[model samples]
Target: MEGTRRTTLVLLLLACLLFLSLLATANSQLRTDFYKDTCPNVESLVRSAVANKFQQTFATASGTLRLFFHDCFVRGCDASVLLFSPSGKAEKDHPDDLSLAGDAFDTVIKAKAAVDSDPNCRNKVSCADILALATRDVVALSGGPSYAVELGRRDGRISTIAGVQHSLPHPDFSLDKLNTMFTSHGLTQTDMVALSGAHTIGFSHCKAFSKRIYNFSPENPIDPTLDRSYAFQLRTMCPINVDPNIAVGMDPTSPRTFDNAYFKNLRQSKGLFISDQILFNDARSRATVDLFASNNAAFNEAFVAAITKLGRVGVKTGNEGEIRRNCAAIN
Candidate 1:
């Protein structure tokens, strides 16, 4: 009986190593053509669904974009953020993620349904891949650059409320803090700045940035770095004791477009988040922000590269994870 126990332990160790090796190999081989044969119309199916959602509400673009970022950062693009828990303890239930709009989850679910409606594609695609595709579609539909997304990701089974606490960047992070977090995921400072450009199309609730306008400091009522006029504007829009759920545009200049205007907003101290303003306030990252603000093409190129790299984080592939039948529940 002791020998049998020892053999079982050995088999478990071997299985773990094999799984790691397969993951490494599969992660490197995530290509755009991963489902060409299995689901030739996968991209189109996802695009159509995302487009329909986008037409219904422009929030669909920002919500889905933010959703993809949240999902990837927490569990490495495994769609773990989408998992629902009966105990009310999944990643989405975490305080940081609680703000994630339902529109984003609906976008992915809609796309998943569209994909599965096709007999050849039913159960053939992973929620992770569908999310990645839907994210790209939303960005393009909102007038951002269109890029090919790497696929072949499988849905992760683990989704714990505790897993999300330290995984995401906060609204008030400094440039140094931002760099430290993004760097851990193999993203450069430029990548961090570029990815942040997504704010051009998103909105942030008053709770996320009210500190800057009302009580930024004991000495100064408003954040010194904020444009005085913009601070007043924000104050008027988000008064004291305003509903925390009441939101404002993340990019004041071009609230609904995906463009370099976010960087431009940073230059004028109109960045809605302290983390956004720091890109220009700190000299080290100021050049990149200035460049992106001046050249839309450069921002688009860097954003695509950065987000493509972001998608590769902590990916589960090559049989390591399953193609979830429903994104909200682990199978």
Candidate 2:
């Protein structure tokens, strides 16, 4: 009888140890209110700063959103994309990132300044956190869901031009390529489709999608998959060998709004980038695209969940990284 009791006690102890281990593993490195005490007004300050920028130019919404995507996808939500290397070789210097709007960087910098203006919060906040908050504000201000963001990420000290190529998905990425790239970061196919919905509020350069409209191939000129009228409109906006710098809204109907219009555009063969259009063309992801196109509420919910997951990618907690005094330079 005593031996039986001893065995039961051992099993109980093992179960407790297992529970504790699982609990620790499940504990996120970040918390929604991490700055509750450190910088009580951090969220409000960022929101105000972002609002001010939006008043000047609605483009700030797209710019900030793109900046967040670039920052998170490369080097895991750290502000490495913001680093300005003196050698003219940095992550942001890469051709893929050349289209990142200056207003986005400016918005983040302005928010950082607002946080620092508070005596107690001066130099106490992480630029990564500021970027995240500003991104959330940009979406909210643009009439999208205002989801709570988890904080406590530290700014990475390293930013290499070479990293950008491997990290960011190109404008011409097919569904398979996008799956591979996003899956590397622990995101699933659903996450990839939902995140792509961010195109609802951004613009693409003429060069980025020129192939879809012109000289797709010798056999198939002007990508037969594109709608006829839509193709004609794009050709008018972006002439062959035209200045690559000319830009057009990704969602021509509602370029500045954050809604399911992007998915709707995809359904109509009006997606600006090949990467965006392929979500609807690919059988593996087409159902998701269709669902989002039909339901704005569903799209918003999925996007918020996916972006929240994105915010946690390879975060640096504890002492792994520093809080940069200047977002563009290492502290």
Report the number of the highest-lDDT candidate: 1
Tens-digit lDDT string for candidate 1 (1-331): 9999999999999998997686568668799999999999999999999999999999899999999999988978999999999999999999999899889999999999999999999999999999999999999998999999999999999999999989999999999999999988879999999999999998999989989999999998999999999999999999998988898889887887888999998999998889999999999999999999999999999999999999998898887889999989988
TM-score of every candidate:
0.93, 0.91
* Over 4 Å off, model 2: 1-27
Q: How well does candidate 2 score on lDDT at residue 181?
A: 91
Q: For residue 309, what is the lDDT in candidate 1?
A: 91
The per-model lDDT (C-alpha) reads 0.93, 0.89
- Model 1 lDDT, residue 321, Cα: 88
Candidate 1: the clashing residue pairs are none
